[model samples]
Target chain A: MELVVSQLLTGLSIASILMLVALGLAVIYGVTGVINLAHGEFVMLGAYCAWFLQTEFGLGLIASLVPIFIVLALFGWIIEALVIRHLYNRPLDTILATWGIGVMAQQAVRLMAGGELRYVEMPAALSSSVNIFGATESAYRLFILGLALSLFALTWYIYRHTAFGLKLRAITQNRDIASSFGINSGRVYRATFAYGAGIAGLAGALVSPLKSVSPEMGTTYVVDAFMVVVLGGTQSLFGTVASSGILGELSGFLAFHSNDTIAKALVLLAIVILIRFRPQGLFAARVRT
Target chain B: MNLTGKSAQQTLLYGAFCVAILLVPLFLDDAFLLNKYSRYLVFAMLAVALSLSWGYAGILNLGQATTFGLGSYCMAMALKLGTVPVHTGSDGLPDFMVWNNVTELPWFWAPFHSMAFALMAGILVPAAFAALLGWFMFRGRITGVYAAIITLAAMVVVNLVIIDQQRFTGGFNGITDLAQFEVAGLAFDAYSSSTYYLVAFCLSAVLLLSLAITRSKTGMILQAIRDQEDRVRFFGYDVALYKIFVFAVSAGIAGLAGMLYTIVMEFASPTFLGVPLSLSVVIWVAVGGRQSLLGAAIGALIVTGVQGALSESETFLESWMLIMGGLFVLVVLFLPKGIAGAFEMLAALFLRRSAAKVPSVSQPAGEAITHGEGAS
Candidate 1:
């Protein structure tokens, strides 16, 4: 019972991180219809952003979140306007182009930061382990779990109620009609791209404490996040939520019996097989063409 | 059929290129340089294989190296089995198996002992996997972005398996210290200049095979399918079979390159099957001009040669990747058709200036259209 409980907690904590990463991915892919191969790099940049702020300015991790979002969103806006905007109508070039951008970003980071792994010291308040129901776990893990759920709730509310959300959805539903209805798709796209990037940045900020910060760190997470988003269905938020949780839990449980690398490989294989059966993913019906 | 004026020009250019390749060893007397050039040829084969699928068939397969790596390891294993130690108690037990404390030879390692089987398996393994994969992806109507993602995921899975099974697969160090590549009582020594001929001869053969395929009626139909699949289906063609065929054949070609790579590089490692190599091969194709097989091969040779030169020199080694990344971006954005495309444009312009009323690019009506690829 203790082992199961501990594993479940581990699963939930991992799921929370996957959720944050996939949330940004799902939104970007949904609105822009881009796989955004560089989305992972955005997360990597976010982690570096947090490390930079904490070291340069002595700001706490919590204090850096807002600034990280703003900076990352601004950075995203520049990239979209300059590069992504030109390639929006040309989908295949976007993949090739974004992959180039991803490589450049990774190399740029490597140049700036060097290749060694860096650690972000966990805050003292959240450093201890907490016992619950005879199972002991890190306080930070629990904090992340709560933080992730709250963020999801906030995102859901904004997505459902905000004017920006409506505008974005309108464009996604029918780009031409929405433009006819006086929606500035260009503005929505820029804003949507910014928002998605901002979310990825924040996820990176939160993730920095848990994993070692490196240029290539985003590669695995991004791939995993893509699996979550792809397995969840391309355009469904609920699907992202459901699939992230299921995959995270399944991977966490499998890791308990086997090793982490094998567990990861198995989970990825399962997702590939699952994709074979339900290419629409876990939630949505086939996209009516 | 008799060749048209444009085709005659293309043939002339191709002959000149092959002659140039044949004469490379004479200009460069250094055995090391000859070996280096041969490795480039192997990579050129990889690039040409990618051009067939991505350029003509419009598959954009992101895992070409997976097939390449599999073939390399297949050849490596067979060669290693031949060098089994006398005191290992069992015949044909690879050194790694002894080091890992395995008492018996694995069943799969058995057939590799026979030279014919190993040579056949080296080509067949990757092709068969691709055929199976292509069937699943194409017949199920899972294509475009999904196909790309699925193939990449499968590659990751296979890579992990190779890494995890350290005892059998040599972990990350990979199968090294491979024996000399021998064929019918003849040895292709790594240090010998003749080894360069072995690779160059095979490369031209593969290149010729690809050119023949692209010119054939089946090649025309494949291009048509790439342009408009639904229309082709309406014309009573089996679309999936053609896709599977091209994909499998492309894999087979990559496998052949992988075998050559094993000989040139003298070892097989996990990096050959990894994402970085796979992506680099795709970029080589993109930079070469995917629409032209010969151009793609040249692209690989040029880009890899430049990369090699830059990476080897101490001043630029650290910054080479960054520059390459920048070049990659510039190519994808501005030079989508690549160096070959630029040359063709220049040639057409010169022709136009010389002959006032001549038509440019006299591709047949049936062979003209090719759609820019995308799922969205």
Candidate 2:
């Protein structure tokens, strides 16, 4: 019972990280219909920022989160305006362009920070383990779970309730119709892209304490996040959450039984099989074209 | 079947390319330089393979390196088996297997003892794998970015598996100190003129064969499908089959290049199957002109040559990726058709100027422009 409970907790923690990394990707791809391959680089930059702050300015990870978000969001906004905006209709070109942007960002970070791995100090308060039903869990893991849920709630609220969210949805449904209804889709897309990038940055910052910070770190996370987003259904927030949970649990369970590498390969195989049956994804909403 | 001015120009260009490639060994007597050029030719073949699928069939297989890596590993296995008994042990097991305490040679590596089997498997395995993957993806109607992501994901999975199974695959260090390729009891040394000629001969064959395939009736239908799949399907073509065919063909080409790569480089690392190399292949094709097979080949040659030269300097090596990334972005943005497109534009302008000089041939000039545009 203790092992099961602890395993579940581990799964939840993994799910939180996956959700955080994939949330921004889901938002950007869902609204803009552009697969931002550079999404991972944004996450990498956020981790770098966290490392920079902790090392240079002596700012705590928690204290520097907002600034990292803003900076990454602004950076994302500029990228969208300059490159992605031109390639909106050209989805394939956007993939190439974003990949190029990712390469440049990775190289730029390597040039500036050197290729060495950097670390972020965990908060002293959340460094200890907490016991639940005789299963000891890291307090940091629990905190991340709570934070991820709250962020999801916040994102859901903004996506469902706000006027900006409505415009964003309007554009997603039909860009021409949304424009006819006087919605400024370009501005909304830019905002959506920025928001998604901000969320990814925040994820990077939070994950930095757990993982080593490096320019190439984002590549792994991005691939995982993409799997989450793709498995979840490209345009659904709830789907993203559910898929992250599924994948995280599946991976965690598999890893417990076997090993990390085998678990990963198995998870990818499972996703591929699932995609074969349902190309529209697990949570696709039916609509008449 | 008519010999139009456009076809004549294409024929001329192909002839010139062939002549240049064939004449290289005559001028460059340095064995090391010849070896390096052979590797560049292999890269050009890879670009051609990518162009066939991506440019013609609109299937941007981001995991092209998967097939290439598989082919390389297959050949590497065969070569490793043929290595000196010191490396293979008294029982003839690979040194890595012996180190890992593997008592027996695995079933898969057994057949690779025959050079013919290794060579055949080198091409067939990747092609078969690609065909199977293509079947699944095309049947599922996973096109565009989704297909690219899936292929990329598949490559990652394979890369991880290869790295994890260190006992069999030689893990991160990969298989090294391979035996030289031989045929009819004649050894082809890596730095020998014969090896260079072998690579050059294979490249020329691949180039011409690909050109022929692209100009065939099936090729036209494939291009039609690229332009409008739904329309082509409505007209009764098996769209999925066509996609799978082209995809498998490209994979086979990539596999052929991979075998040559193993011979030239004399080793196969996991990096051969990694994301960076796969993505670099796409960039080479894009910069060459995805729409033109020969253009894509030239693009790979030039880019690989330049990268080789640039890597000689420490500072340049450090910033090379950044430069390539910037160049890729610029190419995609402004020069979407790439260097080949630029050349075509210049040729078109020259033709128009000459046509204006003699109004009698203006009709042929107009026809040539349309043909050029259509081909591109």
Candidate 3:
């Protein structure tokens, strides 16, 4: 029972990270109609930025989050303006374009950081662990889980209640109709893209301390995020959270008993089988055309 | 008559190109360059397969490396098993397997001892796997990004499997220090410069076969599917069959490449089956020009060559992926057609300018000058 509880906590922490990564991917795909292959690279960039700041200037991990998010948000805007704008309405081209961007970003990181996996020192408070249900756990893991869920709730609230969220949704669902409804679709696109990148940045900053901060670290998570998005229904945020939680927990439990590689292969095979049956992902969005 | 005129020119150009490729070893004395070119040539076969599926049949199989690695592993197993009599270590069973605690060969692994069976298995296993995958995917019309995603997943899964199966697949260390062949009384030492020549000869032969297939009517049908699947279906073509056929053919070529790769490198690792390797293959195709068979081969050569060179350099070497990534972006965004396409376009421009200098009387009826442009 204690083992299960610890597994659940681990699952929740991973799911939180996945949620942040998939949130950006889902939003970009929803609003812009582009499967940005470079989304993972953006997350990597954000993590690297925080790592850089932590190492060079010795900034507080929480304080570094602001700069990471802002810088990535601006980068996202520039990507949208420069390359992604032209790739709109062409899904295949977007895949290719973003793939190019991903490649460039990965190489750039390697070049900048000199190919070594650097360690990020988490703040002492964040590093502390607390006992939960007779199982000792890292407080950092719980904090991340809380932060991610709250962020999702915040995003959901904004999506339902706020003016910007509505506009973003409007633009995504039906661009022509949204334009006709007097919403500036362009501004909504830029904002959503930036917002998505910022969320990914936040996740990266959270997870930087846990994992080895390397140029290629993001690719591994991106694959899992892709599986989550595909399984969860690409456009639905709640579905992403649910799928990530389930998949993460299942894989974590499997890895505990079996080899890590076999566990991953099994999860991938399971996802593929699921996709074969349900071509439209689990919890298909009603608004999806 | 129109077909006859174009095909004749194509035959002549291809024939000349083949001769030139065969003669390349005469000018280049470096065994390393020859070995490198041979490796590239093997990849060229793989690229031809990719073009068959991606360029013609519109199947974006991002897991071709899985098949390539399968073939390499098959060859490595054969070589490993062959060395049992010669290098009989304490407790036998090749050095790596002994270390991993396998006293005897696995029951399924016994057949690879024979060269004939091993070679056949290398090609056929990948073909069988691709056939099964293509059967489901093509039957369901899983094209576009979904197909790409599925194949990408397959790549990750295959690499994971290979990495996990430490005893059979050699884990992350992979299979190395295997003996060369004595097939049909020919003593083939992979380490020698002569072996590189043999590899080069085989590469040219494969290139010829690939070219013939690309120019065939079947190839035209495959390209038509790439352009419009619905239209071909309307015309009563077996769309699924064609997709499977192209995919299987591509897998076979990648298998052949892997076989040659094992012979050249004498090492087959899980890295051969990784997502990065598959993605790099796609990059080669995109950079070379998707439809052109020759272009695909050249693209693999150029990209691999550049990577090899850059990776060797001290200062800029560590950051080589950045350079490659920038190149990928520039090529895709600006050079939509690819390096081969750009070069072809330039050649056409020069030819047009040269033809302009000729008098009006020399120009043929219905304009032969415009034919190359439209066909390309």
Candidate 4:
């Protein structure tokens, strides 16, 4: 019973990071209808930026998040203004183009930092494990859980009530109709893209301490994020959070028993099977207008 | 002036190009350059395969490396079995397989002992896989971004599977150390340059065949599918079958390249099937010009050459991928038609300027169309 409880908690912790990384992917796909293949690269850059700030400037981990978000946000905006702007009408082109961008980002990181994996130290406060309900969990794991839930609440609040969120939602429904209503669709597109990237950046900052920071590590998570967003249905942010838990738990539980590679393969196979059957994804169908 | 005239000129140009390619080793007696050119030709074959599906049929196969790898493995297995006697143990199994530990060979590895069967299997396996995958994908009416995603997913999954199945297949440490061939009492290794000549000879033949296919009515339909798949469907053509046909044929060509690649490199590893390789193929096709077979070939050669040069320099290795990414962005933004197309456009402009001074060299429109690839 204790082992199961421990496994569940561990799964929850991993799911939290997955949820955060996948949240931005879901938002970008939902709003812009582009998968933002570079979404993982944004997350990757975020982690690197935070690590660089901490290592170079001797900034505290908490203090490093601000610049990480800001830098990635600006980067996202530029990507939107330049390459992504022209790709709005061509979803496949956007995917391939962003794939190129992702490669560029990865190679840029490789060039700057070298290909070796860099370890980021956790803040002292979040480094230790804590006893909970006669079981122990890493303090950092709990911290990540807190971050995920808070972000989930924050995204929910934005989509539910905020004016910018409303405008974004309106654009998602029909870009032509939304633009017709005097909504600056282009600005909204850029801002939403930046926002999505920023969230991924924040997620990267939050998760950097838990894992090794490397340029290519993002490919694995990026693929996981794609699976989560698609499984949850690209139509809804709530779907991402829900699906993240399912996928994360499933994968974690499988990994607990089997080899990590096989577990990953099984998960991928499941996604492929699901995609084959449910091309519309596991969310609301809107006639693809 | 019309399509027939253009086609005739294209045929002549293609014939001349093939002859020139076949005669390369004769003029360039240097063994190193001959080998390099031969490998480039193999890469060009793979590029042609990629262009057919991507540039014409509009199915961007992000997993071209998988098919290429399949072909390589088939060739490697066949050669390994053919050279060594069965049940002799160490001499029988390839070096990687011996290291991986297998008491007995798998049943599938049986037929590879025969050279002819191995050659056939190398091409057939990839073609079969492509046809089956294409059928399922197209029948489901999956198009555009979804198809791209599926192929990318296939690459990841296939790579993982290949990594795991180390028993039957030599996991990451792939099959290597293939023996040389002797056909019809002819020493393939004559002059140490004949091997390269053989490769170059085969490549030109394949290139000619590829050009023929591209000029056929089938090629026209494939290009039509790329432009507007739905409209083509409305015209009462089976879009799925057309896609499957091109995809299968492309996979066969990729396999052929893999066969030659094994000969040139004398080894096959998981790196051949990795995402990096697949992405490089995409970059090559994009840089060369997708619709033009010659352009795809040139793109492969140029990019591979760049990669070769870059890897040799530590500084270039660090920054080259970044430059490639930047180039990708620039190409997409500006030179969407690719390097070959850019050259042709320049040639046309020069021709226009000099038209009054020189007599009109009559060429058919069909033939001229080879040099007229644009974003139509």
Displacement of residue A47 (Cα, Å) in model 4 is: 2.0
Pairs clashing in candidate 4? B5-B364, B6-B364, B6-B365, B6-B366, B6-B367, B7-B366, B7-B367
**Candidate 1 at B326: error in angstroms?**
1.3
> How does each model score on lDDT?
0.83, 0.89, 0.77, 0.80
Query: After best superposition, candidate 3 residue A142: deviation in angstroms?
Result: 1.7
Model 1, residue B255: C-alpha shift (Å): 1.5
Judge the docking of candidate 4 as incorrect, acceptable, medium or high. acceptable
Better of 2 and 3 by lDDT: 2
Q: List the residue pairs that clash in candidate 2.
A: none
Once fitted onto the true fold, the runs of candidate 3 whose alpha carbons sit more than 4 angstroms away are A176-184, B1-3, B84-91, B191-194, B211-218, B234-238, B308-312, B347-376
Cα RMSD, each candidate: 2.7, 2.9, 4.3, 4.2
List the DockQ of the predictions in order: 0.49, 0.54, 0.41, 0.45
Q: Largest lDDT belongs to which candidate?
A: 2
In DockQ terms, which candidate is top? 2
Report the candidate with higher TM-score, 1 versus 2.
Answer: 2
Deviation (Å) of B171 in candidate 4: 2.7
Candidate 1 structure quality by residue, lDDT tens digits, B30-148? 88888889999899999999999888887888789989999998888877776746557656577777789987888898887887888898899999989988877787666666677
Error of 1 at B92 (Å): 5.1
Q: Write the per-residue lDDT of candidate 2 for residues B29-89, one digit (tens) a residue.
A: 9999999999999999999999999999999888999999999999999999988757554
Clashing pairs in 3: A107-B322
Please tell me how candidate 2 rates in CAPRI terms: medium
What are the per-residue Cα lDDT tens digits for candidate 4 across B172-226? 7777666665556655542357777677677677667777777788888888788
Task: Choose the strongest candidate by TM-score.
Answer: 2
- DockQ category of candidate 3: acceptable
